[model samples]
Target chain A: MPFHPACHSYEPVTIADRLFLDLRRAILEGELPAGKKISEPELASIYGVSRGSLREAISKLENCNLVTRRPNIGARIVNFSIDQLMEIYQIREAMEGMAARLAAKNMTEAELAHLKSLVARHKDSLLHTERPAKTDYSQDADVDFHFCIIQGSKNQRLLTMLCQDLYDLVRFYRMRLSPAFSSTAMQEHELIVQALERRDGEMAELLMRYHVRASRDRAKQRLESMSPEELGSHH
Target chain B: MPFHPACHSYEPVTIADRLFLDLRRAILEGELPAGKKISEPELASIYGVSRGSLREAISKLENCNLVTRRPNIGARIVNFSIDQLMEIYQIREAMEGMAARLAAKNMTEAELAHLKSLVARHKDSLLHTERPAKTDYSQDADVDFHFCIIQGSKNQRLLTMLCQDLYDLVRFYRMRLSPAFSSTAMQEHELIVQALERRDGEMAELLMRYHVRASRDRAKQRLESMSPEELGSHH
Candidate 1:
């Protein structure tokens, strides 16, 4: 139930760290745009940082799998592809399902109460909204819901893998693939929380995996229905 | 099954890439020693590379989670800990379980035959070995067995996450722990392959998870029985 800015726990202590974070946000929010080449000199001048710091930041980005640096072609913002997105969902289904299972056994009493409150808040938000699917509130709430469970799992490596490395791409895709919110997802969240509350790791894992796979299917259906121009403009 | 040197698939393309691979090998093989501070200038001279290339290699090491860098404190090879090794096992249980499930669904007939042959080769090696538990062949065979299934998953991101990122840490632990091979583990591998052969994704995942959990328990028992000096000397 702890929240960190940019959904990352690491604090920026150096110029390169700060630049990495800022650039990370830029890419996540679609400010830099997907599949776009990173112009070293241009970005350096724009951010008012030296090329050394920028390069360091770029390396950090590469670590997050946000940017791909080619041997000769330089770095580019990771292009959006349905296949890549589906692959991510497959990963999330596995990792987050394990996270939920662990959280059922490992989460503290206070953490369970916090998660309950979060789910309640999301439910409340859903009831008050006339257009819940279009609201960014739904997306943020869903992310918060997942993050709380991931943290509750109490596995540092799992936490780092999901939140620090994979979640960035999760956000990137969510931003570009807007309308990720659905009442069905909220209901799925409620069931997962219920399983967690019972301290049922098996049920928790099953429900979490089900939720993620359903979301993947929903997104795939949406993407398949969208025209090329619509898909291109969605970014 | 496709094999790569040093258990890593990436082919080095530049001075820094080659240096990164070399340093990565040193760290995994215990040549650099666990928990040792990385002296930049010393390593630069040792590797006959410039400070810039060495720094780049060190950064790459950080990405692999093989080195830890602190602000102003410099980088150090990641120290081995029982808790961390157990955590890695938990992660492998989830990711590799999913890989087995997907491989059951996705692997081609030829790939399946290759997997069967790999398992047979591992079984043959186990049968002939005087000390199957101590020989590095058992370890390599075990790694090859997992790598083949992981490749068969046909999920590029999953493959990269497991092979490129997590497997480095896995091999690091195996090298430091030594005697990671066991007939018990080979039997588990055989069961997993049988499930894969039948294309029972559900059973494959269940068996793989059981295998990983059993390995974790075996490792924990071994670690707990060792004295602090024994542990230190083992590294």
Candidate 2:
């Protein structure tokens, strides 16, 4: 018989890794609302991790600007002020534009074919779907289309920074898509795809910037309409 | 009697924090160099930290895109290829442009005064100096001037991301600056200051973009001229 592997049955999960993934998912899914306090002991109990491990995880989040930690007070989810929102948009405008331009030049043939399929599926969904399905499918398609462009850019640093900055914002804005806005978004995606197909780098960059700015305006409008109570509760 | 603090008291530094700052400084100061392998046990010994703490720091640095960690193999510093560099500059062009635009609208009286003083001080240095000072005062001035614009924008997220991305690039490129470039940089700073003073957001944005692009070109030229051995040693 083969010798038993040493310590084969004793693999253990690291507390810090567990807490990092748990908190990241909560923020992405909006289970942890913006500006909510995150107590170390509370998180440690929930994740079955020690306080030391939880603190490490929170430090990582703070580094990403997903959470803010004070020396004595503990950590909280970050809430963007209006001015911060604008600044985020400025970075997004530049990054998305570069992604589009690079995608035009460097996207693989298979990636382009996949993007075409996504666009077609989205169009079909719009034509036959009722109320909520249309919005959901449109939002999913928007993310998939942009994801393709970013991957095509093949710039790891750019992709990483953009994902960290815009992940939550994209999720929040996607939930508020009106039919009018959805249709407009589909049209913008078509323009970007067409430019990429033609390998027109400059035009692709221009269209991508315009598309992000337009989406940002819609999000701003929705944010402005919310009551202070609603905003506070979310935080 | 009042209790006195214990003599010869020692506060133990956490392993994670020590590793984090050491790795961050090494990357920023080009000590480790781009594309160099980072061994965990080696770093642990160097910093007198444990493997667990070193891993935690590596995780954070990976999140920052300053290091890339593989599963079985360890981490390595990032080496951005030419295409990646172009993509980085494209993003910078848009962000620096937007920063200048925002700075024009929002720069405080005190900040404007400080910017003017920075320019005047640099001008005096250029007039009086016979050679480039052993220390790069120009780099300090450049950082201060750009930081002024970033702060004026009052966009925390934008400021944070730009600081991480472009600021590091600026520091890396500073090593290659010649006396000729120093004078040229001063002239460009004057143009930017004048544009800001007139409250011409468009011109300010345009000039800022031009300034960043010129810097990128200079850096590229310097990089191209170096032999592989020279590049390895320089980093």
Candidate 3:
């Protein structure tokens, strides 16, 4: 999940907020499937919410670019095209690179140690397994590592744009490409953490940018290999 | 205006949409100074719209991050701090850099020529001026040059994110800082155009990135030069 630490509340969110969060996660994770039409009444029934609340929630989703709504045709999950996917990678490389640089300067000693531990844990899992490829470097762990650096940047605008505006659009590509980069990815992650540990902003930013660009290139290759129809529901 | 040709209307938008657009522009341009409170009834009467429509418009602005809404206090225009201003620059460098790289590959011959002409026009303005330092380097012209390259990227995601999601947040800082970089900025712009003409993606990306980063550093220095109170309403 894309973390928003500030969104935590002492008072609970409304029924509409809950519905929006659930619907957003489902759509972003592709469980709801891209390009699937939403019948408002049907979804209202499914979520056990009033149609009005669901409509409000859906409007928010549309604002977030998670949904595309037409007057008569209704709403569908957005499918990004391969070109758009590569564009996202380019932007990510820039933003995440800055995040790494800031994190190098801003992260506490404890956070650096935590990052190192996470990388070590992943490497340990790989070594102990007979088939390292089957060990499945967990996506959650990877996201956690990145999220920590992102949050550590302490730049609210950067954090919001990356986590809220851009993260979901890439979930599909990430799911498809994440597991494929294992051993090399581990070395990249560890080196990035080491740069932060040294508080070397330049190296940290360079490594992070390189990592994101590499991933983007790999994603480009994968998408080029696919037919447009198969990448469907890609907006 | 940050053009979104797709956001153009086949059918005219509702009253709420009109109000939202007007209010968003006013807030972003600093016409309605940041941290100024919004009174629903006051704005409703000012806009000659119903309270319901005004409220809807305010909610949309809140979603756009041009305004902040609190339960008891109502809404106020967003005021970004110097740190937040620098944060936005870091992002623009990353996104705009990639846009330049993509534009090198994607821009039509005609588009490249047009970009070159725009740069030539700016240079001519500098040479003919009585006081080159006081010559008005039109922000509109500057925006047009950048906007063309961004759109020429043909990466809809990058275009939308840069144009829609991020551009206006930096306007105040940009308007304040833009003049300082005029002559050299003209040189940088021309060099970038030359790279695009040569279809050199790497050089174009590098030059464009350096341009953005230089602007950012200048903006940062300006903000740092200001006293907290002088910066005013910086949140």
lDDT at A156 for candidate 2?
62
Which residue pairs in model 2 clash with each other? none
User: Which model, 1 or 2, shows the larger DockQ?
Assistant: 1
TM-score of chain B of each: 0.91, 0.83, 0.87
Residue A125 in model 2: lDDT: 78
lDDT of 1 by residue, A1-235 (tens): 1225434547778998889888888888789978889999999999999987898899889989999887656899987688888999999999999999999999999999999998898788778877645544777778889889988998888888887678888788777665657889889998999999899999999999999999999999988887876655433
Residues A1-235 of candidate 2: C-alpha lDDT, one tens digit per residue: 1001220112224556556667866875568877789977787888887887887778767755778765456788876665566667777887788788888998998999899898888877777766544425466567678878887877665666666556555554333334334677788888999999998989999999899999888767877777765554442
DockQ per candidate, 2 decimals:
0.72, 0.35, 0.53
Error of 2 at A218 (Å): 1.4
| Runs off by more than 4 Å, candidate 1 | A1-11, A133-135, A233-235, B1-10, B133-135, B233-235
Is model 1 an incorrect, acceptable, medium or high docking prediction?
A: medium
Candidate 3 structure quality by residue, lDDT tens digits, A60-97? 78767788776556888777667667777778887898
Sort every candidate by DockQ, greatest first.
1, 3, 2
Candidate 2 DockQ score? 0.35
Residue pairs of candidate 1 with colliding backbone atoms: none
RMSD of each: 2.7, 7.9, 3.5
Please provide, for model 2 over B1-235, each residue's C-alpha lDDT reduced to its tens digit, 9 standing for 90 to 100.
Answer: 1001121112325556456666766776677777889888888888887887788788767755677765466788876565466656767777777888888888888888989998899888778878766764666667777878877776666676676545555454343334234677778889998999998998998899898888777767776776656545433
Q: Look at candidate 2 and tell me the lDDT of residue B11.
A: 30
Ranked candidates (lDDT, high to low): 1, 3, 2
Q: Would you list the C-alpha lDDT of every candidate in the order shown?
A: 0.84, 0.70, 0.76
Candidate number with greatest TM-score = 1
